[model samples]
Target: MIASGCDCEIFEAGPGRVVRRARDGRSLEREAAVMRHARRHGFPAPEVLDADGPDILMERLEGPSLMEEVASTPGQAAEHGRLLASLLRRLSGVPAPGWLQAAPGGPGNRLLHLDLHPANVLMTPDGPRVIDWANAGRGAPGADVACTWLVLATAPAGPSLEGWRDGVLAAFLEGVDAAAARRHLPAVADRRRADEHISAVEKAEISAFVARETALT
Candidate 1:
């Protein structure tokens, strides 16, 4: 077990994991490219120091996890959501290298960060540094947003659920025109319809249910 100074609990076993093996050169290369792209495009992510092999040395961040940091605060949650929305827009605006491909586990035709939870973000002195880029790629920003909302809805709920919703929508759409948001809401919402159609989220009550779970815990 290679325990670095930071929160790195890596293993050097040859089990196909990055920190477990001496290789996965292709995966390392892809990770480097993604990190570089995020950096160049101004997305808050870790800096890559070495990307030659399985053990891609990189800068580790310090500070609170976005989840714990804002777990008790709705205002903070809203602001964070807004920032994420802006970040997604910026990342999508840029052209990713050819190597970045859509690899959704479920049936989908768009790129997405299928698992974007707050735990994956590492807050640093600069700001929130996006920790995990393994699930990022060219996909529907709407679905990404939905997945984001899903996690947000599931995480530690704030004092006021409706207020948090207001803040998230307000911040997430800070620069977006009201008309545009209204117009695109349906399309953005349609992406989540797959889950309902497939019975993953069979009813509107699911959102409230998740909120209750987070709050009660």
Candidate 2:
């Protein structure tokens, strides 16, 4: 078994399946349900093999995370960005389940992966499969995209990573409506600020970005 994060541990149950158990049983069950919903809607995600209380058994996907691949192969930034954009677009078309709450918006009922980022994507032999559905919910597509933008912008970085970040951002924006994403920056920032996991530095940065974006609105 391997520790995945503060709340969960993962174990390779067999050649074809892995099990994830979270500290919060309810959250784990919700995550499993969201993953199943995503897979049913044709999203490239792990199939749920079984679910019992806080433990979820899922198809074991073998591959390095997209974040690792992008860091090692900077030249493939554009391709990876395009793939990510396509996945987001597909996700936008999926209807959120009734249980999920909308992200302070009206008119759209899209399922949102509130924490979509390269680290959550794995490049399997079949394709790029998204994981970590614990934060999945309902929201406007623009808001969801804005959350992704903030994640990319605030990721720990050094001078050398700037070029790779810009390359990926440029490619991703080419496939998305930049104006729409900008419109939701404030709301996204507000939501992120409320997350207990965010550090003071990140909250300040997000606040500044939100202020700038709000001024333009």
Candidate 3:
């Protein structure tokens, strides 16, 4: 993929994943802090081998990504629904140090991986490895779920795509405050404004998903 943005080339590697700096020193430091905290709390994630400015060398994961696995299943939607919820819950339980984002940004007291999506999850032989902590921070847990729903809703679907998006989304909303989680467009919109740029269509889809989930919940 082409680079240059909020964090450019941020991923240079010598053998495995050697660096992740394109984002800058401050970004690298924050990510490193989060990674270290995750590792300490036993979160299945990459090890920060080194962190110097925007450069962050990381341990390479040795396994298939969740994106790859999802391609092979007829019931892929269901599988992803189950996997995403369980993993996020586990991540929430992992306590970061006091210096980290200790307080929730809003209602929920759980830590959130703002960029949670299937692409960031690697399905290793041992278990799932959550990657890409660039957008991670302390926030309501529902924000994370809202992000996931946005992913499913906005992901490209060809005429050949066979699964039901609604079912997959429902799978994601099976537990907790599924309704309130869906109606989090304002939060999602705010997040997009502060960080990455989600497409207008994608944002609209997210808004719709948020509404639908809110209604169904």
User: Which residue pairs show collisions in model 2?
Assistant: none
Against the reference, the lDDT scores of all candidates come to 0.54, 0.82, 0.67
lDDT of 2 by residue, 6-45 (tens): 6678988988889999866554777888889888999887
Question: Which has the better TM-score: candidate 1, or candidate 3?
Answer: 3
Which parts of model 1 have CA positions greater than 4 angstroms off?
A: 1-27, 72-75, 103-114, 155-217
Error of 3 at 6 (Å): 8.2
Best by TM-score: 2
- Deviation in Å, model 2, residue 143 alpha carbon: 1.4
- Choose 2 or 3, whichever is better by TM-score: 2
* Predicted model with the maximum lDDT: 2
Give the RMSD in angstroms, all C-alphas superposed, for model 1: 8.4
